[model samples]
Target: MIDFWLAAGLLLLVALSFLLIPVLRSRRAQLEEDRTALNVALYQERVAELQTQQEEGVLDAAQMDAGRAEAARELLADTEGVAAPRVTRLGKPAPLLAAILVPVLGLGLYLHFGASDKVELTREFSQAPKSMEEMTQRLERAVAAQPDSAEALYFLGRTYMTQDRPADAAKIFERTVNLAGRQPELLGQWAQAQYFADGKKWSDKVQALTDEALKADPKEVTSLGLLGIAAFEAERYQDAIDYWNRLLEQLPADDKSRIALQGGITRATEKLVASGGQVVKAPVAKATALLKVSVDLAPDLKAKVQPGDSVFIFARATNGPPAPLAAKRLTVADLPATVELSDADAMMPQLKLSNFPEVQLVARISRAGKPTAGEWIGRSQPLASSTTAPQTLTIDSPDK
Candidate 1:
């Protein structure tokens, strides 16, 4: 019952504040200006009262001293007609106002102009099959416009997988591989989809695709990574190291890639050591020629240069004829192409002429199907004999 009274009193006081607040604020301001006069008058009255009480033997001198000290330090207790709190209204807390306003504006602006509703769609995609169906239908329309679109089919499968529609995605992936012929990244995606669909079961097709990818391009980094994992799973320690080494070679020698590469290498190397096997290296070839190259373009470089555009770069060799990569026949369609010397376009390897020996370097950039520009960087070496051994050329050293 007391608690109820207290709560009711608090609410009543709050309800009365709206009518009393402005007047109370004005009175407080007036009190600040007139406080000294009022205090002095009160002190005078207290001194007179103390004297009267002392005369009647009520308060002693010590009590009077304490009273005066307290009177000097504090305002007198409020009486019935005492002025209310004063001052030109209190200042609002700017930080509190900003805290409320900031979120309102930020969320309002973000929804109005910042992010698309599509971002949410991707997040809750599993709940919305209709959106996925529409996306697939749109992709079908696009593929119909271009019958030979391998990339489109690949994208379609990826969309279906993202929506957790595995069966539909599997069909699309199967079709994409047939159209594109062979793509390592696409194959990886297909295998990954199957693994996810079957609760992480490994299929023979996965292994076959990985092998074919590595054969298609020795520098296929992702294939090398898959091969490394497979080799480790099979307890082929040296084979794992060889595959990881290929991946390491293709990675940039920066702090990020260096740390990851070294970590993988360390793992494989440790396993190889435990098995008493050596990590395999590329066979070294003996020759007395070299080529130097400086890249002027990067793969996936989104510049003004587009597909079917002419591209150019400079190269040099140290020994023989730069016959194969004619400067005028270079083009851009040969993606991820290396600069090496060639005799009538028959490509061969070479060293950097310092720490390694073996050179037959040529430089060429192709546009569509024809070479648009090229230049030999060093003296070329004539091909003497074909062998499995190819020397590792050091591209790190600059002419010093």
Candidate 2:
């Protein structure tokens, strides 16, 4: 920001020079005009003296003419190199006043309308924060500077949750939902924050939020974790085990939280056994969905497309979000090849194929390797996500 202001000040100085330089030059021209007038007066005085001598018979006509010629020559010599006086419609004071007002008015307008606060926020974020508190302060200022920024609000809410300010986190998450739409992940965060904010007591509003999130995305991790905690707190050990097991399945092998989550499941299972209740394991095979697809270029497009062009095979929910439930990547040369898209290939855990009842398969050919859009595309009819039969897709039509 300091560098930016310095550059702006330099530009202002350049602008002021344009207005000031002309005035300074006009002053120099005035001085030259005044000196020329003074020399002409001195020449007239010498001519008057010579005429007086000739009238008194001290000099003849020829000598008098010579004397006048010498006086005129001296006047011309004194004024020889002087430039013509400049004519200005606006005098010195006007340009000087303009020079003063240009910067002042420009600065005033810029302060009122420019993105200086955003610039400051950017500069602050470039440095590593010394502490969490300092980072929080910067995020708060960023949210204040850009109230409409959903991404900033989401981060601030997460930060508040880490700081144990659940009430603040809940409010920020609500704002985030309003600005960014009721996304499953955002809904899960909002529900978790609201649950903690209400002193760990469940409410109808929290229930609604969690239900909506899970309905949209069954594998929403935050909501799953939150429900497990709620069930445990309510002394429903079996219910806690169920929710934790569902969450555990969604986690990756390398996730640091997996150890703690496994411990939680074990604790829940032990408590359920102590209560003389039978523990029922969830059906693991039913939870995993896989689609086998054979993709190939259309006969008509074979001559038009390069063999090295990229091909994307993916499945998206027919009745849910536009995001792919599962996807695969290959090259055009690999066409007429078989590929598999499973829950393991899910773009997001909450958007897995097992979470949706029905989906559509799409195959696209793109020179740019982008999945969302491409030159040629083919789509299969809506089919059950749990379908075991092989599907065939050919890239036959231009992408709309």
The RMSD of every model to the true structure, in order and in angstroms, is 21.6, 7.0
- Model 2 spans > 4 angstroms off: 285-400
Q: Residues 5-122, candidate 2: write the lDDT tens digits.
A: 9999999999999999998898889999999999989998998999899989999999999999998989889999999887888878999999989999999999999999999989
- Regions of candidate 1 where Cα sits further than 4 Å from its true position: 1-149, 156-170, 191-202, 254-258, 274-400
* Prediction-by-prediction clash tally: 37, 0
Error of 2 at 368 (Å): 28
In model 2, how many backbone clashes occur?
A: 0
Give one digit per residue, the lDDT tens place, for model 1 in 1-400. 3554476557655654654565556657666647656767887787788778877888888987787677655545433356554334334344345545655675578668863444433444435446667877666665665557888788888888878977677677778888987687776666656655655455787777766766776666656776676677767777777777767756655537658766877887888887787777766444333333333343234353445655443222334444332222334454334453322222322112321223343333333433433221222243332222342222221122
Best candidate, lDDT-wise? 2
Q: After superposition, how far is residue 16 of candidate 2 from its true place, in Å?
A: 1.5
Reference-based lDDT, each prediction: 0.55, 0.92
Give the Cα error of residue 301 in candidate 2, in Å: 23
lDDT at residue 179 of model 2 (Cα atoms): 100
